[model samples]
Target: MLAIINDDLAGAGRPESIFISWLLWQPRGVDLASEALKEVQKLARYEKVDPDIARLKALFASLAGSDRSMH
Candidate 1:
């Protein structure tokens, strides 16, 4: 499933590619997910802001504070 999504993301544009990058990082663990979120936030500054980005940032922020392990 990840491989399939990665293949699709290869051709994706801008913010979609950035968001997909975070999706790919998610299952690895909280550390990676946090790192990916930071990268997303940083990259988002250079691109036109999207409402979905804010939503995703909020989602990631909540996940970061959760005690549940991703694995």
Candidate 2:
């Protein structure tokens, strides 16, 4: 499942590529889903501002709010 998403992300390009990078670089034992959520939050907070990424941040924020497993 994750491999499929990673392939789709690689094909799609840009911000998704960033997500793939994050997914690959996470420390051992970190939860992949939670780390992905944190990566989305960090992208909006620390990276150069991108309107498209800001929109993605909004969506991720909503998902994180509802998904207690991410916390």
lDDT for each candidate structure: 0.47, 0.49
**What is the per-residue lDDT of model 1 for residues 42-67, given as tens digits with 9 covering 90 to 100?**
53453336564444445454445643
lDDT of 1 at 25: 56
State the lDDT at 61 in candidate 2. 53
C-alpha RMSD between model 1 and the true structure? 8.6
Residue-level lDDT for 13 in candidate 1: 37
Query: Poorest 10 consecutive residues of model 1 by lDDT?
Result: 1-10
Model 1 misplaced stretches (Cα beyond 4 Å): 1-33, 43-48, 66-71
Which pairs clash in the backbone of model 1?
Answer: none
Q: CA shift at 19, candidate 2, in angstroms?
A: 0.7
User: What TM-score does model 2 achieve against the real structure?
Assistant: 0.41
Give candidate 1's error at residue 6 in angstroms: 17
Overall local distance difference test of candidate 2:
0.49
